[model samples]
Target: MNLSRPLLLASNSPRRKELLAGLGLEFKIRVKEVNEDFPEHLKRAEVAEYLASHKADAYQHDLQNEILLTADTIVCLGERILNKPANYEEAFEMLSALSGTSHEVITGVCVLIKEQKAVFHDITKVFFKKLTKTEIDYYIRNFQPFDKAGAYGIQEWIGMIGIERIEGSYFNVVGLPVQKLYTQLKALGLIS
Candidate 1:
């Protein structure tokens, strides 16, 4: 089909852009806002997957015979879903709790083409080093991690200094799981 149609990224995340760019595929972004909420019955992975698929739904009419990608990443520590922090205090609290702990980073993704849609997710286990109060405070004040889930960025200062190790895809901690995404996109004939 000759790349049939240009790939459309239904997100504004810079991390997603970076991840997609690694594929060496051409794509364009059209920011469309979607609610990050889900039903109370939805569990951890379900919430992420549902939100990602919902993002793709925004471009249903705009989509032709092309691939539209959408994704949502969430951090879960125990039963608590630590979403993006609202303020510095909350951000500090989130990071403090994450210190010296392992948390799950789940990303739900959707690859939509016309009527056919593939929805899936990748999980990464990130372990942080025990961060001192001063270290956490420094990160919060310097990075202002309002754009990141769990109030921290894996590629930022906190990640470089605080993240001790990870058990899964590093890119997944950053945002998108490029390896899984590559396999899925190739299987769906979304990329060369």
Candidate 2:
């Protein structure tokens, strides 16, 4: 794909990078550490959008001829948001809570070009089969999903065996919602 402006991706997430690359759009990775904190009142999609925009805001002064992309993915179980786990115990607990349940995976994306910005979010409902304690422990010990939100990767072993189905874009669960992102880029006349 050809972009009208050079692309700068403001994230270090390997999953996000891979997903964007799969879209065949070339971009340079230019991440700066930004505060991921958000207000307590923001719910699922709101939190993700807020964080994505917050990341984009860090690059506000850096734009020249390049379009900036930032994205944040969050997992929500009912009213609770499951952030990345701090350690093995947290990962186990997160997976336990997610077992035999349906959760929403929301990926919020921000595309910024000079003074213009577009922010949107995509949500995927993921259904998990009842996972055993052993399965949870095994996944945590072997996969080490400390960097992934919800302490799980949908393309990993746990998901291969535990996820029963998904109602939205599967790529959204991995990290990026490429379809919606492509639409947004096209709408902005960044891609043809």
Candidate 3:
């Protein structure tokens, strides 16, 4: 793929990097520390969008000829938003609540240049069959999903046995909605 500008990915997630690479675009990973905080009143998609845009904003002043890409993913179970777990207990609690239920995974993406900016979000509905405590414990202990939102990865073992179905893009649940992101980039004339 040929890009009109240098693509800079502002994230540390290997999943995001791998997903983007799947599109065959050459890019550079440039991660910076940004607080992932959002206003309490912001809803599911809004929260993800805000965080993605927030991360992009951190590079505003430093950007010269680079096109910055930032993304944030969140898992929402009704009104509650399940972020990355801090420890094993939180992971167990999150997976326990998700058992035999449906949840929305929203991933917000931001594409920014010195002159132009675009922010958007994609949502995927994931359904999980009933999961046992042993299953959750085993996943937590072995997979150590402390860095993943909702304490799980759709491509991991738990998803293999636990996910009943999904209503949207599987990649969205994994981390990035590559299709939507590709469309956005193409529309922006960033890639061809």
Ranking by lDDT: 3, 2, 1
The numbered model that scores best in lDDT is: 3
Q: Which stretches of candidate 1 lie over 4 Å from their true place?
A: 1-4
Q: Tens digit of lDDT per residue, candidate 3, span 1-192?
A: 889989999998999999989989999999999998899999889999999999999999999999999999999999899999999999999999999999999999999999899999999999999999999999999999999999999999999999999999999998999999889989988886
Alpha carbon deviation, residue 123, candidate 3 (Å): 0.4
Candidate 2: regions farther than 4 A off:
none
Q: What does candidate 1 score on TM?
A: 0.96
What is the C-alpha local distance difference test score of each model? 0.88, 0.94, 0.95
Per candidate, the number of residue pairs that clash is 0, 0, 0
Candidate 2 C-alpha lDDT tens digits along 1-192? 999989999988898889889999999999898989999998888999999999999999878989999999999999999999999989989999999999999999999999699999999999999999999998998999999999999999999999999999999999999999999999999997
Span of 10 residues, lowest total lDDT, candidate 1 = 1-10
Worst 10 residues of 3 by lDDT: 183-192
Model 1: how far is 33 from its true place, Å? 1.6
Q: How does candidate 2 score on lDDT? A: 0.94
| Rank list by TM-score | 3, 2, 1
